[model samples]
Target: MDLYAPFVRHVVAPLHALYEGNPIYSILRELEQTQWLSPEELRRRQWEKLERMVRHAGDRCPFYRERFAAAGLDPARFTLEDFQRLPALTKADIRKETPRLQAEGMQDVRIRQGRTGGSTSVPLEFVVDERSAQRKGACALRHNAWAGWHPGDKVAMVWGATDVDSTFKLRMRNLILDRRFALDTLRLDEAMMHDFARRMRSEQPRVVYGHSHSTYILACFMKKHGYAAPTVKTVVSTSTVLADVERAEIENMFQCKVFDRYGCEEVSLISSECDRHEGMHINLDHLFVEFLQNGRPVGPGECGEIHLTDLTNVAMPFLRYKVEDAGTPTAHVCSCGRGMPMMEKVQGRVADFIVTPDGRVIFGVSILDNFTAKFMGLERVQIIQDVIDHLIVKIVRGEGFDEKVVRGFQDRIPEFFGKEMRYDLEFVDEIPREISGKYRFTISKIPNPFQEAAGRAIGRTPPA
Candidate 1:
């Protein structure tokens, strides 16, 4: 037998077993049941949980202990205000503190090491324990519950990853769960897309979940061929930005509700769109979220970078972690009766913002919607803005490609800025995937003088 087989059976399999039956899953179920709680009651319980997590981190995590002390505060006496006083932690901070954050005398404090898909070009490495991994899975399940799916419901996952080799244990688990996994690491060609649609229709999954881009590509294919996956109850989009236009198109083609989820590898579920679809409801029970602009808290309905603390993950607690995404906070109570504050909109990642020559910022997602609405037979597209006046449109086209689609995209962009802008369309055979096998929608190459002057400047380079 292979030498590694023993390790998988003894270590990995057992860990997986523990993860599937952990208390985190139970906690998630409990939260799902509390979706009917009043706004005030939900707020009270969220704060109580946040305080407990803060105290736990102060007592167990050395990094947080030093942080609390340096701020001239006591963790035991910590309140919501005191928690807000702590400095926000960025990806750079986590990289710098990796060694110190590890537990004493432990060779590998991380039970698992997760790699970000390099959506920002600066792919992150986050460590998670067994409990944290379980929590992440449970949170994902709760999001699926929004679409009326149960634990054993048949589902199909179309996602990209660097590691494509699945072990025997994983295969068995998939079989037991009645789920199918599709690898969309390559561009969606006509033949491949046809095969995918065939499999999807035959399988008749309860829900389909994957990257928003890939899902949209599939939906486009179905729309053109007059095919629909009628049995699929829901199409869940994650891992990348999903525009309203794309969501509507997907729902129309797939004949299901499009539930968009937002989160990172560090924390499992941050916020999810509810049944009412008013906005994303923040998972305040498991996370404490803040919107910060210029290092200060922004009030309700203000847009800023999202800073979050994972109150559940004690092994590698992220205290005020800068998520590098822009969004607006909403104090409006949801019609669904969940008291969690709504995230009115997630304006995509900071890197997705295009800085124009006149110092105007255009949201990349808004531009993507314009193209998706008018363009056809397009597999993937990336927008690169090097300067205010210069823009590059990289298009991976499908069968029967024409310049008319490109012209249509060009025509719609001006409406986004309310001004005519100069851009060049370049058709390519493929848009290269990033190191982690995910495609980024936009990249800015123009160097920011402030970042360059700091001498820690890193250039932005999108894959291909």
Candidate 2:
């Protein structure tokens, strides 16, 4: 038996169990249990929560209070219909008003500062209080529940960040949470991957969760090399768009369901696909989601920008916050019996949309899918658009990278764009990580004023 197995079962398991019973956890658990409410009931409850949040912010948050006053809006009489009347708050708005947003009488309003890994180069710093933190943790647990993960189920995380310090509190928390593996995604070498495969086979984790791109890359290597790992019940991909090709390959290679999750740092676990394999279930109990087109709410099944209001985050409430992601709204009920609203798909983040010289826009994931089939053992790559007619391809060459693959991409790109664009292929040993430690596959240096304005409104700079 592994040396840490006993500690994991006894100490970590019990601690996680205790944490799962915390007040906030209980509240979230109750909501999840009631997720089968009728559509009308769900809407009623959502408005109630929204009203409470408006009142709370109007009283406690100096920023929202003043904004409401200047707009001649009364928080006490705020209605669901007035959602459009409220000004959208972007990441920039939050950053600019952080000082005023701080709770007045609370000396320790500093709580905790966290960074958002936005597609735009500009990251954000936000404060979270104890209640907010607990709510976030509970939301994560609820998502885990969809994959048959229990309170004490052993879990492994393949994450990008390398700043985890094993302090006493963290150590205790890990023990309680039954977390066995915390592999650093930055060091994804053959040896590291082999070691991870061995650990997974030995530990038999209930679920494996991580950045989709990195995990899919690892799975691809394992499948090509015929390395067998322990069977996980499910794999949850977060923080990036999971292309259909990647999803098919991952599911086949790992022998598990590939569940894609859409969320941001401001509100963790906003929507997740359930076991029924339906669309991503929006957490209506804790969030009020709006799909807007040109500043107006769109009807069901229409594509639009995603705006969200966090009902649980009282510390620094985010009201009608622009998340900068596009998706199609769905009013269709799920067979899974969950009354939570669903989103048909999260069309990739705003930065992933590339404008061509001919004014044609292409989705980043679509281009990657077209190229992946022609390339073998390509570890990572980045596509940079400097101008309408020029593109820089940064390739992190892997074991079998050859001229054939390069020529294939070179030929296919122009064929798709219908123009002979300048394509530069620069091969490197490894793609450099961003300041947040995650790699962005697409960036644009050319300034689109509209995109820049949108990015600024959301507190992120246009991706470049």
Could you tell me the lDDT of residue 253 within candidate 1? Answer: 84
Candidate 1: 10-residue stretch with minimal lDDT: 455-464
For TM-score, the strongest prediction is 2
Task: Report the Cα lDDT for candidate 2.
Answer: 0.71
Candidate 2 total steric clashes: 7
Instruction: List TM-score per model, in order.
Output: 0.83, 0.87
Please identify model 1 stretches exceeding 4 Å from their true place.
1-21, 103-112, 120-123, 162-165, 186-188, 371-380, 396-421, 447-464
How would you encode candidate 2's per-residue C-alpha lDDT over 331-401 as one tens digit per residue? 77889888888997776542345677877776666677775556785877888888878888888887788
- Residue-pair clashes per prediction, in order, are 1, 7
Question: Candidates' lDDT values, in order?
Answer: 0.68, 0.71
